[model samples]
Target: MNTSPRILVVEDDRTVRTVVNDYLSGQGFSVTAVDNGSEVLARFAAERPALVVLDRMLPGLSGDEVCRALRATSDVPIIMLTALDAVPDRIAGLESGADDYLAKPFALKELKLRIEALLRRSRQAGAAPSEFGLGPFRVDPARRHIRRDGVPIPLTTREYELFLYLLNNPGRTISRDEILREVWQWQFGDPSTVTVHIRRLREKIEEDPRFPVHLKTEWGSGYRFDLRGGEG
Candidate 1:
C-alpha cells in the first residue's frame, strides 16, 4: 500500500511541469501532472490530492478561476506558481485562495518544504480535537473550522492558522515579522503575505472590514485581536 501524499501539479510549461513532477516523485510524493487549468477540478476530484501546485497563467479558465472553483468546496492547500512576482500579482494569487505563492524561478527544495509544511499542518489540525470560543467566534479544531455568530466562515488553511493564532493571543500587538515567523513558519519572506491574509480574515469576520472591531491594527506596531470589542 502506497500511502504517499498525492500532489496535483498544474503548469502549462512543459519543462517546468516535468521537472516538478519528477522532483516531487523522487521525494516520495504521488504526483499527478497536468498542462492546463481546465483539467484541475476533474483531476482534483478524482485524485483528491493532498495539495495543488497551480500556475497563475493557463490557456483557459485561468488559474485564479480554477483556484476559486476549488476553494468553493475544499480547504485543500494550494501553492500558486507565477512568473509575476509583483506585490499586486502575489496579492491577487493569495486573494484567489492560494495558501502559498512561488515565483516562476523558484527553488524546488523550497517548494517541497512548503508542501511538507502544509501537509504537516493539515495532519496536526486533524489530530487535535478541541472546541473553544471567544466572543462571537468558535473554533472546532478537529474539523479545522471556525464560526462567527453561529455562521461558519470559510477560510483557507493559511487563513485559519493566522486567525487562530491571533484569536489565541487576544489583545497583544503582533508585528508582521512575528506573524510571518509564527503563523507562516517562515523566517524570511514577503510581509505582504501576512497583510493580505489579515485583510481576508477581517473581510470574513468583521461587520465592516474597513472599520474592523475585533482584528484591529495598532498603528505602526501591528495587529491586535479584541474578543471583548467583538462580543455581543
Candidate 2:
C-alpha cells in the first residue's frame, strides 16, 4: 500500500484540476483528481485521501453537500475552493465544515502551504496524556475523541486540535496569531478562520455560545479557554 498521503482533488475546471494535480503530485503527494462531487465519497473510500481539495461549485452533489457528507463520516481535512472571496461565502464554507478555504485566483504556493500545515497537524502523533477533562469534558488523544460527562462530543479535526491546544494551556489568553502559529501551524493566515472554528467549538462545549462559558473572547486580545468556565 502506498503510504504517501493521498489527496482527493474535486474540481470541475479542467485547467484548475490539472494544475492542482500536477503541482500537488510534484510536491510528493499521491493525488487523485475527480470532477463531480457525486463521486467524492466513492473516491474517498477507495483513495483514502488524507485531505480533500473541494471546489465550492460542483456538477452533481455540490461542494457544500459533499463537505457535509464527509464531515458526517470522517474528520479528514478539507480545503474549499471558492470563486468568490467574499467574507460571507468563506464563512458559509467553514460553517459547512470545511477545515480550510482558498479563494479562486489564489497562489498555488499558498495552497501548498495550507495543505502542508493542515497535514502536519493531522499527522501529529497521538501520544498525548492518557486522559484530560475540564469539568464534564475529557479527551483521549489515542482514541481521537472528546467527551462531556462520559458522552462523546463529535468534533472535526481542526476543532479537536484547537480544543487540545486550549486544554494544554489553561487560563492564558491565546491570541489568534498565536493560535494560527501553534495549532494551524500557519505563519500567516486569515484570523476569521480561527474565529469561526472557535465559535463552532464553543457551540459544542458551552452552555450558551452567545454567552460562552468555556471559550471566552478577550475583547480585542483574541480568546481564552477558561477551565472554570468563569464560574469562580
Candidate 3:
C-alpha cells in the first residue's frame, strides 16, 4: 500500500537540493523535489507527501508564508531548513508551524538522521487504532473521532494526535522529549508548545480540565495517562 515514507524537498539552491534529494532517495523515500513556494501547494495536493523538507527562504512564497498556508489546510509534518541561527528565528519557525528546524550548513548525516527520526515519529503518532478506551473517552483512530459516554467531542488535528499517543501508552510516563519526538516529529521542541497543547487537550477530553484525572503531570518527570488510576 505504498508504506514507504514520502518526502517533499523545497529548496532553491541547486547544490543543496541535489545533495538532499540524492541522500533521501538513497534512504528509500519517495521524493518530490521543487525549488520555490509557487509550486509547493500544487505538488503537495498532487503528491500528498507524508513529510516536507522546507527551506525557510524561498523565491516566491517565503518559507514562513508557505508553512502558514499549509498549516491552514493540512497538518503534514514539516522540517524547516534555514541559515538563520538566531534563537528568535528558530522560535518563530516553530511558532509558525514547523515540526522541526535545522540550521543551514548542516551535516548531511545529521539531516538524514533528523528526517528518519521525524518519519518514525509521524508513523507512530498516526498509527491507526481500531478503538481505544480511556476512562470514559472512546476514540476511533480511522475516523479521527472521539466520544465521551457517547457525547461527541471536537478536537484539532494536533490535539487528536496528542490524545492518541497518550491513550496508546496509558500509564507510561512520557517525557517531553518523548512526546515531541513521537507526536511532533521533532527531536527537540519548544516546551511551551507541549504544555499549551496538553492544556488544550485536557480542556476537550477531561471532565474538568482544571484538575485532570486522566492526563496527569509527574512533577519534574513528564506526563502520563492513568487509565486505571494505578489502583487496579
In model 1, state the lDDT of residue 65: 97
lDDT by residue (32-92, candidate 2, tens digit) is: 9999998999989977888999999999898999999999889899999999888888988
Better of 1 and 2 by TM-score: 1
Q: Show model 1 residue runs off by greater than 4 Å.
A: 230-232
User: What are the RMSD figures for all models against the true structure?
Assistant: 1.7, 2.0, 5.1
Q: List the residue pairs that clash in candidate 3.
A: none
Q: Which pairs clash inside model 1? A: none
Residue clash pairs of candidate 2: none
lDDT (Cα, 0-100) at 21 in candidate 3: 94
Clashes of each: 0, 0, 0
RMSD of 2: 2.0
lDDT by residue (64-177, candidate 1, tens digit) is 999999999999999999999999999999999899999979999999999999999888975786898978889999988999888999998999999999989998999999
> Which is the winner by TM-score between candidate 1 and candidate 3?
1
lDDT of each: 0.92, 0.88, 0.80
